[model samples]
Target: MADTTGTVEASQPGRYSVPGPPPRPRSQLVGTGFAIAAGAMAVAGALGHYMARRHASGIDPGHDWLAGQSVPNPQLVYALITLLVSVVTAHWAVWASGRGERGHTWVGMALTLVMGLAFFNMVMFSLNRMEFEIGSGEWATLAFAVTGLSLAILIVGMFYLGLMTLRSLGGSVGRDRSTPLGAAVFFWDFAVLAWAATWYVVYVVK
Candidate 1:
């Protein structure tokens, strides 16, 4: 009977064995990723068209692109800085949620929300103070269109963040339930990047 006891125990149906690692939690992250990619492509296309128009119509001698329209550079700079800070807060929220730090997560989300609102206000102020009307000319129209698209995207991201924040309040944002928070952060970060590009092209390049 060479190792009969070991063979008998191994053959038992209910005998215990070393457990493997826990299964990874399922999430909607993949779907969110696809959506973010599509939104980014749309923004890129709009920016590309705007740049092409600027080069063709604004660059030639005696053909001013802005047509003497004044862009509020100071306000735009503030808005970009606000958005960059929001990026940090948004990531902070995700990080805290992953570690089950509910208080820190709430603080991070709240700060990000406040920064986002401030940025929106600054953008609106800049637009209101601008001398050029949206219907002024081709250049004016394209510029407004690009900036307006960025605002719309930012609004969507804010909406996502709001919903996730509400979910967090209901105790749905811990280590095992952080997927929604992560998705919101991803979209908000995308919004920030889109606005950064828009700021660079429309404000800096002009």
Candidate 2:
């Protein structure tokens, strides 16, 4: 009496639906959101630090203490680098998520958490020492702290994504894992280098 013909055909094996790849995972949204938030914070911190330094030195907007040197405006440069790293890490998270993987590797996550905390401590200690010596006001000190914290978050996210990419390279995790892994390695290592340079130049030398 009813439309039983359609129901009968739907019951047939491989008749109602065509075989296809599984739906892609959505866990990457978490990492991407984190990366973007960290980037926003990083930009704010960078501006704060730059302004504080400029104010301390009584330098006009167009001038810098290292005007004679080729690599002037260290704070702004560091901010730009952090922003770039954030973007790359976010992209990696999206790519990995699209592969239908459930989530990130635990080892990578642990490593990133540890390194990020350590890096944050180093940055804060160095900046605080400078603040103490220079007797900077509360606002300037706050700015430095903000910059350090933001960069720390960025580093953790980036490191996690980088290590994940590296892990994928060991096996056939993805078709082009190597490419992303290379980028991860570069950015992760660059962060370390940048930290060391910043410590020496900003805290020790300057």
Candidate 3:
């Protein structure tokens, strides 16, 4: 034993260390929202294609043609305005959220204020023009049914989010940072779901 080498190995157990910065950049509203919206739209689009083909024989040309009547409808003006404002707000929110500036609070507040008005206007216009009665027992009925239900959901959800966003901005003055980005993501997801459902009905049932 004395002749053997006296060197001994350090026998310490490996220890786990606390995580530091994230492996990747933190995700913002736009990043995740885009993915979600895109996915929903894709699903809707595929379903819509299938429905359109299947219901082609059943779809009444007279009924389907009515959609053309509203082509370039005056409602487009309001819809465009809403789209533009939302786009701007979305861009700003994404930028601000990415930058982590507390000032995005003000941007979110402004967006919520203006978007609420646009949302109300659109809802009024849609409600005024949209009317449907029960159709013959067929794909027509199914399409109409789905579209109507989807529209109802969209109308309620959109307005609700608008109110929530506005409240987050305007409920008393303080430096409390609001999760406007999260609201925006939620709103977009709602919209995508509505569009998918509505257009799917139209495409397949038509």
Candidate 4:
């Protein structure tokens, strides 16, 4: 009864639980930006594909002024799917990064960033091929060569990042964090590969 409360509190100093690391303000801001961008891309991809399909079909859909590209329907659909998946996973990664689990988010975002650029280029190449009926001449050949090299590098980068992320999970660096960022990274990696395959079928085979 004499100072019993004080003795109990002293024995369990952390009974109230220690607070986690403070939120990284700058990192959270960047993460939010990435999430917003990803959401925008998702919406854009959906709308753009619908318009493109309508344009090709000559529906004259009013909301889709940018819809009427000459690209094949399947390719447009593939692109839409790819972009949507990329955006969704990217946003998830960003959210995880904002919560202090950065390794997976970083890997995922880096993969998407590089792969997104390549995807953009492939889209342009497809547009030229479909709209202008451009054949695989010297320029096209060189472009494909570079794209192939870049794809190789991209695959290697993804593997390296994935391995590093997995390693970090077992180490002290990532031990304090709890997020499924690694899953997000793997998701984006799959999306990239799927996009590459779709591009090959849509552009290269044509």
Candidate 5:
């Protein structure tokens, strides 16, 4: 009975120690990588088909592949530039998140969102300027298909970005919890690259 409580506490220190939360899963990043690879292959295949069709049409000295439908080159260039800037801001968000710079992270996310919207608006404006009629010819249909696919990808990327931003604001993203933001950034970068490829094939090439 002599100091029994003191003896028991001394013999079981681990019994009173609290355990920390489990490590977050890495599946999100891995799944995103697979998605990006699949998307890249799909886009490459579509672009290759477009090139084949163009080549089949025969590019003689005076033959125009577009059949006189003028592409808005200036607007397309500005859209690409906007996307490139968004890529920087997206990466900045991830970088700041990893360093625990919450303020910088928020700014980066906000800027990236704005840039993404700007790119979308520019693309829409360019499409309007082109006055494309899907029923006009095979070229028109192919052009619309390619651009539509790229825009769809961009929309998905922007949606993911918004979700990640919400999570970050809720304090779910931080130094040790930046994987979600990183995944979003990766997807956004892919979206930008997809659009660039679309621009080169659909605008710059012909």
Candidate 6:
């Protein structure tokens, strides 16, 4: 009756049939990071979208346009989506951790993907493609390069993780499957560190 494990043992009320090492209890840091990411995005996305909407003198109100422009700015919406997805992944990680093992690869992959899209597509691309342009500034150029690199890394990391997940999937089900998922999630999480640090240097602080 667990999300990661689809079965429960009748003999042991709190026991599951999933095989594996005792689930690695996540540190507070992991949970806190996930919560912060989600909450910050929700609040920030709402505020950003609202501001863009109100400040746009020419934006269309009919289709959620911010500046009366024909094109709709789904930037804020995208941020919100990433935040929500991250929240869900964090919850799954916690649940599986509670059960004494990491959850499925689906959960880990989902986390990697959510973070990638948000950190790369939403935050990085938004800054480069929207906030700044090719002729904007020296700093802008640097930002573009760094974000581009992060996105590149994200793509490669996803592919590697995908392969790892495939190998794990070829094995028996249950606890057997959690390790690759955990490893992928862990590696992808490391990608976040690379991404944030790199982008921060190029864009935020430079």
Quick one: best TM-score, which candidate?
Answer: 5
For residues 1-206, could you state the per-residue lDDT of candidate 2 as single tens digits?
77666543347776667779775554454455554555556655665565567467645422443333332344444544444454454445435534634254333334444445554554455444443422244334544554465466446646655565556645524433334443443345444444544444443343
Displacement of the residue 114 alpha carbon in candidate 2, Å: 18
The order by descending TM-score is 5, 1, 3, 6, 2, 4
Cα deviation of 50 in candidate 1 (Å)? 0.6
54: Cα error in model 4, Å = 11
In angstroms, give how far residue 109 of model 3 lies from its true place. 5.2
Candidates 3 and 4 compared by TM-score, better number: 3
Q: Please give, for residues 12-84, the per-residue lDDT of candidate 6 as tens digits.
A: 7546666768855655336545644553454345334434443452444333322222322355346445644
The prediction achieving the highest lDDT against the true structure is 5
Give me the displacement of residue 150 in model 4, in angstroms: 24
Q: Which scores better on TM-score, 4 or 5? A: 5
Model 4, range 115-149, lDDT digits (tens) per residue? 55655555655555554322434233333443344
Q: Report residue 67 deviation for candidate 4 (angstroms).
A: 15
Worst 10 residues of 6 by lDDT: 63-72
TM-score, predicted candidate 3 vs. hidden true structure: 0.48
For model 4 the local lDDT of residue 29 reads 35
RMSD of each: 4.5, 10.0, 9.5, 10.8, 3.0, 14.9
Could you tell me how far off, in angstroms, the CA of residue 43 lies in candidate 6 after the best superposition?
29
How would the candidate models be sorted by lDDT, starting from the highest? Answer: 5, 1, 3, 6, 4, 2
Model 3: ten consecutive residues of lowest lDDT? 171-180
lDDT of each: 0.86, 0.47, 0.51, 0.48, 0.88, 0.48
Clashes of each: 0, 0, 2, 2, 0, 9
The RMSD (Cα, Å) of candidate 1 is 4.5
